[model samples]
Target: MSTTRSRYTQTRSSTISDDQIADLIYKLQQLIPDDQIHTTTLHHHKALNTKVLEETCNYVRRLQREVEDLSQRLSELLQSMDNNSPEAAIIRTLLMSP
Candidate 1:
């Protein structure tokens, strides 16, 4: 007889929750109307959706630029610290250590 064991110990759960689905459904309902729910209206909806998505992407890009600027400023400030300062010495030691 042979004994078998599983190597995997954990299971992954879905990233999307019920609340997210409900919210998406609500947004879709708000975007679509019963009278305008025909195939002919799809193009109009698609254009509006594209516009909104583009705006969101632009906003995200702006935020990313701001974050990058702040990070660069922080790095410059850290680099400006005196090498003999306690904080700078600790940082240098940590960087040199394995």
Candidate 2:
């Protein structure tokens, strides 16, 4: 009787975990654009997840580079302005704040 109860508990727990995993994977898939999951299998979902993650990483890196370039240009432009100007002082103060 104990063995049977243990098996039943384990099976139920596993099923719930599987459901949770599927739900998370579905959410992740929805976040990535152009990700199409055609099959209802774990392998296909895993593959799509990997692809989505790689694409997201690459996109984030590209955006970081763009932000860095823009920040550098802004700093240079600010430096070229007259240091005594009210506008430059305001901008420099804003940039220094968290």
TM-score of each: 0.45, 0.54
Candidate with best lDDT: 2
Q: After superposition, how far is residue 49 of candidate 1 from its true place, in Å?
A: 0.6
On TM-score, the candidate that comes out on top is 2
Q: Give the TM-score of candidate 1.
A: 0.45
Candidate 2, lDDT over the whole model: 0.60
Candidate 1: global Cα-lDDT?
A: 0.53
* RMSD (Cα, Å) of model 2: 20.3
Give the Cα-based TM-score of candidate 2 against the true structure.
Answer: 0.54
lDDT of each: 0.53, 0.60
lDDT of 2 by residue, 3-97 (tens): 33343345445433435545655687667555454455656667767787657656655665565565656666676788789887787676657
For 1-98, candidate 1 gives per-residue lDDT tens digits of 00000101111122334466456655764665656556888778767765775566566556655655554554455568885798866755653477
